[model samples]
Target chain A: MRRMLKLLPIRFLSAALIYLVAGITLGTLDALGYGSFKSVHSHLLAGAFFTLVIMGSMYQLLPTIIGAELKHRSLAEFQFILANLGFISLAYSFLSNYSFLKVAGLIAFISFILFAFEIFATALSVKDFYRRSLAIWFFLAAVVYLVVGSAYALAGVLGITSFSAARHAHILTLGFVAMTNFGGLYELFPMLSLKKLHSRRLGEVHFFIANIAAIGMFLGFPERGNLFILSSLLFLAGFYLFAYNLTRTYFSKSHGPEVEMDISARFMAYALAFGVAGVTAGFTSATLGFPGSFTHVHLILTGWVGLTIVGAMYHIVPMLTWLEKYSTKVGQEGVPLIQDLYNKPLAKALFITLNTTLALFAFSSLLPALSIFAVPLAIAFLVFAVEMLLVLGR
Target chain B: METLDVRGLPHSERPQLILKKLEELGELEILVEVKPVPVITMLESKGYTCEAEQSQGVWRVKIRKKQG
Candidate 1:
């Protein structure tokens, strides 16, 4: 049961590493006095942390979800080491402003490309609609976007692009990372909640539309306002449909949904809505410019992306660990459910406080008066750390 | 004596797993209609009621009576 706990550190390692790096970077960038080191952190979070976690979960997820023997276990085994090494080098490069990160990115890019090829071959080998469709849709979209986005960033690194390098960062973060994770969510979440999904049609709809929107917006930015607007609308619409279906799944189930779902799934639903708000604001707020851009990234990262990852962790951790065996055993024998393993009150407080702090951080002019917001957000992380430790049984 | 076809088995799953699960629970001789990968070819050769076929990643199996 506890074997899956190893996957925990791998996932949380990235999460914590991201913030730790971001905090240092932000402290360094405080001289600017407006936005922090978000521009840099966006790339790090999307490329390194998000990339690592998604790959890890997919290893855990693809086989279980699709009921297929992993195509090459040896390759899967090596992928973890290769990816993390590349990520570490890339992060170091970013911090040191070294050319080596490009080399690291190249290594990581090769790993990703190979990973994508393996997933494609593995999926095509499957004979089931649910499994194959999910594998195909999931790996294909995730890999394609990630590859292109990474290639673009790598091009920037090679000094080929005329634009600011940050543009590539945006494409990688928003286009590749977010699109991939969100697509996986549609397949993963309903199963976690023990409810039937609304429609595979809607699933495909969300997948294609969001990808098209992201790709179109990326390619057409600054020159094609109409295209960007249309793309943003499609992205928002896809999210809305996804959230709606997830909500229905959680609520529709007769076997009262798990505490994990209650906390994570519902939070993610809010995050999706928050994402819509953030994107729409960016579309309309040329007055805000870069800040508006950061706002959108924050919403997707902290709101939608962060919420989903956290919620998914709660479910995936226990499911893979075989901890659910204890619950089912306890249930049949008239014992309590697995609620004892978690601290709900602490999480609730973190949710409320963190949500408020992020909102203030993004939408408010109160930084002058409420300059103390960082303390609470930091406190929220403290609480999160505690709960996370409890989940890990630390 | 006759074969009946069932629909709505999502188009991508392995037909054998479906058939096996159904065969485990149901009381009928497994008959093949159509499938991409048929599980038991010997049954088909014996002129058993079941047969399978595959089209566009979808498999359908049918069941009928033996010829005598």
Candidate 2:
């Protein structure tokens, strides 16, 4: 059981790094006037990279955070296998074999069901309602989005239903990816800063508004109508609420020396800024029929989701690795601090370069001549991969 | 039973302080503002027993060396 707890997150994070590289490679190629591989790229990053990281983090943290034993512990390893296979198959279908689409979709759908069931069961076992943090609620909601969005997408893929690809993307992106990140930030920001949430009540309100906006936008997309406009407004409102809540939580007065924001939290702060920018761009693109749709998507996916995962992994990887390697030896001998497990200078470098690359990439979307930024973006991802792998080695 | 108040300590300093205190005292209680899940997990993994309870929004965790 201990070994499973130790190894599961590492396995998932290692896999996410692989997918990140592949996804970024394809994205860079697309930017260089190569054949359009947008579908494959999106699947690799969103379906594989994001999903793997979220699954791994949840498996590791949920038990600790919610004060409940994870239900179906043994099945989590099997679920990981299924998730990887399903995503690989899906990526293959997008790249080459259309016949593999249905099979891939089924496999991935089953994996999603297993994940949702496991998490829901674990959460339900938490008899104490107050112990069930707002983060758990976000996680539960994300898995719901995962199952429903994937089913809808599979139906569309199988020609059983006609729907806009954008709608399916929004379901997974806004509902699943964004919600998971929100939950993570909610949990992590407080823990890292050693502060309680600024407004639990406001967070609850944000959750409902975000969910309604996600569903409303899904129902309203491909048509710039009242529903779409209202949903867009709601979406912005939710984002602002989240931003304000977390900002206050982190910046709230500490009785002792002010808790300095570490590099990890700094990354998250920048990620939230990017999230605000992304949603604003998304609203403009939807309401005004803007030409730079790609800008909004890139900002959200790369700037928002990508940075959040990276930031989280910085803290999580070191802590997990420290727990696995040093926890048992604490009193027996001197043990290295969790912060000492990772290279600080490399982390700082990755932070600066990754954000710079994201800014350049966003600009590149507007000015085609600036597409040269893709090379730096790819390099930044490579640096991230290397930095994370190095942490594992330490 | 010594009571170690770790409310304002940096996260990196908490574990070491707890372990050193445990090594010196054999058993102690910690007062923390947060749940201190990681500390509890580490202590248990290191062959210590821990029980935590909350009162007045503060967590009081008792840690003892496990008896053979």
Candidate 3:
């Protein structure tokens, strides 16, 4: 049972890396005008990379937050296997335009349903739900979005709904990925900074605003009018609330000198700032109805979601590995902080390159000549993957 | 019995605050009002024996110095 549980986080992270490579390769190809693999790229980014990574983190986090064992361990193991297989099949089916790959969608859908049940079964078991942290609220809400988003994807796969790939991408990316990131930020910002979260009230406000914006934009994007602009404003507002609360918390008095304030913490702050820029870009794209509207989505995906995840893994991977490896050595030997697990200079370089790549990608839509950024972006991801592997090696 | 309620704390601070209180209390018998289930292992690792029960929608955990 314990073995099964351990497999989850590792497998999820591994799969996420694989998906990231695939997603970036596909994106590079599309940018270079080889083929418009837009749907495949979105699926790999939203489904394979983000969703899998978030789910993996939840497996590690939920039990710790609730102070209990996760319910349905066996179910989770099965879901893990099924989800990976389903994703591969689903991606292949979409990439090749094979109708047979629809079965993969069904399998993935079942996996998500099982995942929702796993989350609720574990989370709801807590006696007092109200005392649960703000992160739990966002995490549970993300689960709801996941179930809903997966259902939407299934419908699209089955041809039962007119839900376009673009709409599904927004729902899954914002509704699932961004929602999870928000919840994760609430917990991680404090943990990494070694300070309590600044304000629960503001966090609550951020949650509602972000969710409203996500749902509203998902529905309003097609119309591209007042609703879209309003939703974008709310989204921007939500990002602002998070930025304020997190920054305030980070600078608030900590117990002591914070554990060297790793590159992960810096990355998180950058991601928050990027989130603001992305939302602003989104608003501009919506209001102007620009010919290069795709830039906005690229900004959000790479700037907000991509950077945040890469940054988070720096802390998360080391923390988990330490628990597994050096936990007992603490108080007995000179145990290193989680920050020491990874190369800081590499992390900073990755952050810089990633942002530069996103900026170039964002402009590439406007000027196809800017597509030369693809090589640098690919190199950034390669550096990131190698750094992550090195961290795990330690 | 002294009681420290972690209900109002953020998730990140709850465990830290609880651990700090336990360290300060040292040999005293204290009732920690927390989610309880999550802190049991940590408490046990620190040489404290604890038993938790839920009452009125909150967990009440009784902790004392471990008997040799």
Q: How closely does chain A match the true chain A in each prediction, as TM-score?
A: 0.80, 0.95, 0.91
Measured against the true two-chain complex, the DockQ scores of the candidates, in the order shown, are 0.04, 0.50, 0.15
Q: For candidate 2, what is the lDDT?
A: 0.84
Question: Cα miss at A305, model 1 (Å)?
Answer: 0.3
Candidate 3 regions exceeding 4 Å error are A1-5, A329-337, B1-68
Model 1, range A1-394, lDDT digits (tens) per residue? 2533345334534354444445434533442365545434544556665776677666656654444546876675666667767777776776675658678878888887777766666665667634444434755677777778777767767778755454565576666667666666666555444455667777777777777877777866556467766776777677677667666765674333233445655566666666666666655553335455545655667666766666665555433332323322322354323344566787677778877876765543324444345556555655564465455542
State TM-scores per candidate. 0.71, 0.94, 0.82
**Local accuracy of candidate 3 as per-residue lDDT tens digits, A250-302:** 78886554345656777787777777777777776667766355777777777
- What would the per-residue lDDT of candidate 2 be over residues A263-361, giving only the tens digit for each residue? 677888888888888888888887785636788988888998889888888888877777667766777888888788777887788888888878777
Off by over 4 Å in 1: A1-40, A129-136, A160-166, A222-224, A247-261, A286-291, A323-339, A364-371, A382-386, B1-68
Worst lDDT 10-window in candidate 3 chain B: B27-36
- Candidate scoring better on DockQ of 2 and 3: 2
Question: Lowest-lDDT window of 10 residues in candidate 2 chain B?
Answer: B8-17
Model 2 - which docking category?
Answer: medium
Query: C-alpha displacement of B22 in model 1, angstroms?
Result: 22
